[model samples]
Target chain A: MTENDILEAAKQAVVAADEEKAIEVARQAVALGLDPLRVINEGFTPGMRQVGDLFERGTMFLPEVIIASEAMVAAVAILEENLPAEQKEKQAGIAVLGTIEGDVHDIGKGIVATLMRVYGFKVHDLGRDVPLQRFVDEAKSSGAQLVGSSALMTTTMVGQKQLEKLLKEAGIREQVKTMVGGAVVTQYWADKIGADAYAENAQEAVAKALELVEG
Target chain B: MTSYPTRMGDGHAVEMSTDELRCDILAGTEDAADRGRIPALSQEEQDYLLDLFSYPGKIVGVQPGNEVVLTDDGSVNALYGAQSSSGVGVPLSRELAIRVYERAFCMDTMEVGHPDYSFKPVKPIVSLEQQCLESVLSSTIIPIYYGAMPNLALYAKPDGPFGNPADLLPQGKISEARAAQEEAAQALTRDMVYVGRKMAEVGADGFNFDTTASAGDAEFMATLQAVEELAKTTELSIEVGMAAEFVLGMHGQVTYDGVRLAGLYPHEQLKLVEKAGAHLFGPVVNTNTRRSSAWNVSRAVTFVKACSEAASIPIHANVGIGVGGVPMCETPPTSMVTRASVAMVEIARVDGL
Candidate 1:
């Protein structure tokens, strides 16, 4: 009905992880005199912020994350549809995300990617068991603002440090901000490996990304 | 007719080695003559068979499970941990691996109670339990000296990753719960060292550790440290079981409606466990067995992600023909036993046992 109602509806849809509803409400909000930027900035992003918190707390698991991310994508999908041709072509900063080699766990990475998408970050997702060079190469080619890797095991967590080394060896250390996380990854270890930042959870990753961007 | 259905130790004790007894049992089974067997065996059978077989050493790799499955490689896999009857498996053909495990684990551990069980208890549980125990004690067990006494080797998950799970998240709550639960379970087990010491005092030798479904990786290692201490003053050896929790998220605490949790969060706790020096691991997630709630195959496979996370230790996992809770399903005994056996072997292959 009103612009306020439409935005509220869109926010609820994202939190509920209802894609079709998110798209419908997003479109309706735009039609009801809501700013496209406002709907995204105020409505969709906050829902995902909560999703990140839930995931970190383990209150939400994989299926729930998938649902919430779906809604975020749906709203984004609708928003992109209404943008001017030139604006559509405009890209957000790039991010390369992956789980380190020998680690097949990807739940935390998946949440980070979805939240990044909600924030209008262009993400190149490299699924589980990613080799070190693949991360380095993606960062070089994409010129990503952040190169992120997750390793749940302490043994494999060494891959994160390796990625950072590869970045330096490739002479691109300053070009890409390397971020790493997993159960065993502490801020101290981040300093040890020269990772620019570390997110304790998916939400922290987003905040870290923002800080890294601004800094 | 000593009410064959209710006989106890119907056959004479074997003076030969358990391996020889096994051969004799096989011979008797093949004889098609008068057959006698052990009576109804509870899990207590492990101990009964240990004495019956008259072996001096602990058991190792002889297949242990109640359910069996044939892997593509022809090795036997079995359902290990908490079962009505235990199993002892050996390498048979691809086809035989399944058949043998099913017969050993899936079949009734009792003697000829059922009229159709005209087959004697002679080939029943006592022989199987003794064989399983001896195989493990004889080999899978090592005498590691922390002080002056020997602490037996515990569960190892070479496929697991490192770190306590909740550490993977930003939330202190998740890690807190995981940490607390592991602390409690392991503390309980570590204290069992005293009980084990008492058992060894009376010639019990060693007791198995049921470390399944534990919560924290740190707590597990602490428990082991405590047990290692107790062993210095006692004569007991220890065998530990791996839990679904360390590999999967706290078991009943989390599930993926249908998707794989293992695939979703590949880096959790299993690897850190190995760092603590656990050399053996066991897996046979009973989470989805018949009595288990809402859990499914997708949830079970999530543990697979932890499989490659650790290295240089053997791990064991299993499947049941009946699905969910692999514990209750009534399938052929051999398949159940083999399922458990093969899981351990696979862990050995993949984890560098």
Candidate 2:
């Protein structure tokens, strides 16, 4: 198949949530001597975008989006290994994501992390029930441009504010942008907590990360 | 069941399915559109209902229609207590010094929480509940003690047998889940019984196991065990309010009274609630945030209707924000909530909201 045809096939594989097909498309792209980074950006990543659009349009559910993401991740893994050093360096930004301490609900946060990674950000997902100090430490250690915290419960959401305070105390607050999300989290809560962004869902999380990192 | 023209989560117009509302509820789109009209609602009634979305309001109300009984969990706490983060209520009462007890007497029945509203399995909260329970009990309103057995992962590792489910689920640690389910069930049941007895001693009219099975099958089993034990130990009537539409089956092997606990729908859950000796049952139908209120209500009412039909006990459907067809917003729109409430009462035939 021609390069454009192969790329288009890769995109279709992700949309179909066919993980095997995605991996095959990635390997075929590599075998045909196509740029691995281009395959991800031009093919697999756009498919993830379409998945997000379908989700926002209410045509898709969480499980489907999750599977489509998994498919894209598998294909991206194959392509990432083949990318040249110069292309590998062209990440959009580094991000740190987690569910705040005392809140074990992280499905939403996990989705955000996955979508952010698909959007070309190097994400350090801290996992659920993450401590406030951990966010500060990770931001400092990774030099991440964006740090996102999710707290599904109202009792635990206060940890996001404490995280903001901890970042400032650690002297890295100015260097990093902070985003807070979860079921109970709102734009008002984000503003009150002095966060840079508040994404309602994974799709919006990706858009917000781009604005925070590049805009 | 008939198809209803409803908005998806993004406020786009669509027709919710008749038979396939559950799938449509989750995906925020209708898969099967029978396109049958609402025979109960006249064209004018349908137009008025649909216009709730078009003409939005800060706080919407029912059209002075027939009233339905309301039962709340963690209600008063949303006003003057620590739970009231929004700070939109009357002056703080001295009785409400402790943050987590939601003692709303205004409702048909008051649902008061243990002093620690998070319902953590801590000891000090028991004494606090005992101290606060007397003031919350009223002769006019049936007072229920509300609490939850949050997922075991909320408790940290080593101290609790479970690791974070966020990590475990993706990692697929089956044995770890089995071990955690056993240990956490024991811990949660102990706490529920102890607090439940203490509150019963203080004269709570009933017990509401709010958000039970949040950790899936294991947690559901724990709640059932607690309800069984509490029923035997104290005379306090018990009600079990579920956390989600279906049991997550996190611990797929867990069971109550010979029946497997995982993946039970509302109707199935009601049987267990009854078996566990609960007088009332509140079934939760989760709303997709991206789906319109019309879709959510249609979906929520569908599940609730089935559950209610199967229920021998009163079914007080959880029509809250993000569940029971309510919009998934911080402050749910009044129009949508009222619409959902009306539908639950009319279509679902729920005993209470």
Candidate 3:
């Protein structure tokens, strides 16, 4: 099969959330001596980009996005393993993401992590109900420039403000950027909490994370 | 050729033919599904849903003689509701809330969240509710129910007495989640019964478990257990208001009445709510923010209609803010809200909102 045909199959595999198809396409691309990075950027990445659009337009739901992301990640991992050390794409930035303390919602945060990883960010996912201090510690240890927190409930969202305060207390507030998001989180709340950005969903989180890292 | 009232994806008012609505409803329900992961509504179910919306009205409503009771959670805060930049509602005094419920909103049934808002633990809010009940039972004719969430997350780490599964399960500490969940559930049940009996003694008409099971299946099981235990003594009306259309099985293994509680939708949820001895059931259907009110109403009615059909007790569908086909935005537009309300009552035949 042609290289272009294999790459197109890779893209469709991600869109269909067909992990086996993604793996098969990755293997075929490797057999054709195609650039692994090209397969990711030109193929699976665009598929994820379309998935994000479908999700934003209400044509897709969270579970589908999650599945698609998993498929893409699995495909990317296969592609990355075969890449020469010097041929790897440069990392975008380092970021830490988590659902804040007292909120056990990880699905949105998980999507954000997956998208961020595809966008080339070295992400440390702290998972759900993460302690506020952990964000500061991870930022310090990893020297992550971007930190994102999600809180799905109003009661637990108070932890976001505490996270901002903890970052400042650790004297890393000025050095790192912070983004807050969740079902109930708003730009207003982000501003009130002194967060650098507010994202309404995972797609927006990736955009904001990129903007924050670049700007 | 009858045209029905509905809203566009952007919340604009619109009219559509029965065929258009049927397509929209089917498509909308499809969108609401997990993209072939969960069960899609069968064609027979789709036909039943279309029939519910088949009535011709600019906006349908219950017949002139058949009005339903309007019960609400977080109702006291409706009038005195303070929106902060942080989106937290400001807590108000018991007396001020009573005035707002009676003099302002003139609500038939008065319900109050904790002074810190309803999504808090009842243990700390019990005295506050007691203080409010002392004033409410004497001052107004409105029947009052105490409302709070079974927020199991709060029962963990620096709050209550359990390990945070959020920390445990993620770290591959899978064996500990079951025990942590059990302890948290027990604590939540104790607090609910304690506060319930306290309100019952103070002349409260009932207890409302608003937003039950938001934390997951463990939280839901606890609420069911609390309802059963409370039913033994107090004749107070218990309302089980759900947090979502389907139960997320965070604990995954939790069960009630010998049936697993995880993955139960509104109809299945109501059956357990009845078995648990709740006098009222509030089924929640989340809205797709990017979809039209018609789409949301159709998808919501698909679930609520089933719940209403199976319900023996009162079914008060939560149609406010983000659930029950209403828009997800704060201050959901009155036009769509009204249209959704009308469709719910006329189509789903819910007993109340």
lDDT of 2 at B76: 51
lDDT of candidate 3 over A73-96, digit per residue (tens): 788888898888876556779999
Inter-residue clash pairs, candidate 2? B7-B292, B8-B291, B8-B292, B9-B290, B9-B291, B9-B292
TM-score of chain B of 1: 0.34
Q: What tens digits encode model 2's per-residue C-alpha lDDT throughout B309-337?
A: 88899999997767887766546655567
What shift in Å separates residue B245 of candidate 2 from its native position after superposition?
4.8
- What tens-digit string does per-residue lDDT give for candidate 3 at B171-266? 335458668888989988888888888888887888899888877788999999999998888988999999887776556677898888766878
The two-chain DockQ for each candidate, comma-separated, is 0.01, 0.11, 0.11
Ranked candidates, highest DockQ first: 2, 3, 1
C-alpha DockQ for predicted model 2: 0.11
10 residues in a row with least lDDT, candidate 2 chain B? B30-39
For DockQ, candidate 1 versus 2, the one ahead is: 2
Candidate 1 per-residue lDDT, tens place, B132-241, comes to 33333333222211101111111111112232232223222344434444444454444445444543444433443333323323334444554455546665443334
By DockQ, the better pick of 1 and 3 is 3
Model 3 lDDT at residue B4: 69
> How many angstroms is residue B229 displaced in model 3 relative to the true structure, after the best TM-score fit?
0.9
Rate residue A118 of model 3 by lDDT: 60
